[model samples]
Target: MPENPTSQPVPFRGGGFNPRPRALIGLAVMVVLIAVWETGCRTGIIHPLVLPAPSEAATAFMELVDSGLLWTHLGASLSRLVIGWTAGTILGITVGFAIGLFSLARAGMVPLVAAIFPIPKIALLPLFIIWFGIGEGSKVATILFGTFFPTVVATYGGVDNVDRGLIRMGQSFGLSWVSIVRKIILPGALPAILPGFRISAAIAIVLLVAAEMIGAEFGVGAYILMAGSLMAMDQLIAGVAILSTIGLTVSWIIGRAEKALLRWRV
Candidate 1:
């Protein structure tokens, strides 16, 4: 049979929505913005007192480095961030797995998570201080609490969303319960869980700042608070830049983790 003359092969339209990595584009955008900001400050389009130049912020950052206080402030924040975020992540994963794997745990914990999740964690800082005192304990507790709920949500949500077909297939193969959970469920849930980690990390930083601003003496938040109180915009911006750097660093770490752990997807 002859093919119809008007019939043309359909153009391929199955391009996957995979993102291409053009990291330079992002870097260029940031550079352009900073250039504009610096030019504005130089030309008086923006006031110095209102917003210090990026150069000024850099100078202040250098001052911190020279004075050796950068490490002091940074070390304190890192310790808290690491401790609190790690603790929260561990517990969240545990609780989330519990909720996902067992019916009784789900019935008991889901409502509890829902009820407590909506409350502002920053608001609880005062209560934490009252309970744990105006020290590292309160600050750590604030970050921990802030991180925990979202992680729990992410963990259980990931688990629930895992393909039951895969689970059934494993069972049909006579895989043990622990083996199924370890090999199938854990990997399936990681995509969700890792991003949840990103969210929890961001929350932990915010809570850390808030917690530090109240009573701590040596953290990025404390540094920013002091700079603001003294009307030192450069130093304030420097402190903020520090926090941003920390966030970027955390994001990069997580990205590396995703690449390492999710190689099977590719």
Candidate 2:
């Protein structure tokens, strides 16, 4: 007699993916932390000089807003970030694809990228200033340079990691080279590439701040530097908060892009 199929144990699926509860919980924890911090500051348990309360930072942020300095600083930083990051990402993607696909590019660019990537990008700021000058050119170049190597590494690595089976299958089907790359390789490599964007974006922001701190008259980094020099913890914290917010915003945008682009995976 055959055994009943129904007698076999079914595999368990994990809990359903509901993000709302987790998000709400995270928000609650942040609120609680802020409340505790505020209470501590008010009770003199935490020194204001060392760590300004969230309220104090908020007040400082508002003052910057009223003085019209916030936009000036923010606009300068945003301009540099957008231009530099965009240029780096585009060039990196192009070079990375070449390195991944062509033997000559891999031989030449791989060694160059590997060499430059290990160097601290901030240390190169003075060199860029000399090359591009002390104006916006140097600052943007710093961010671009910082962003480029990571993007190149990520893109080419992603391409290399694409399954050989898929490429062979495409070739067997008599697909053209361009068609195979467009359809099979790019889609396969996208999962890795998106994460790379996140990393490169973060690096770009750091380099942007570093570049601004060196010679920039108006930028978030410059504002933070001034605040620190004056020992104004509140304003400094506000500058930091702004940077944090920008990071979160970039992450959110990238997340949305991933969702849209990788819908095929789901």
| Residue 218 accuracy (lDDT) in model 1 | 97
Off by over 4 Å in 1: 1-19
lDDT of 2: 0.93
Our tally of clashes for model 2 stands at 0
The digit string of per-residue lDDT tens for model 2 on 104-169 reads: 999999989989999988998899999999989999998898888998999999999999999999
TM-score computed on alpha carbons, candidate 1 = 0.92
Worst 10 residues of 2 by lDDT: 1-10
Q: Top model by lDDT, which number?
A: 1
Error of 1 at 44 (Å): 1.6
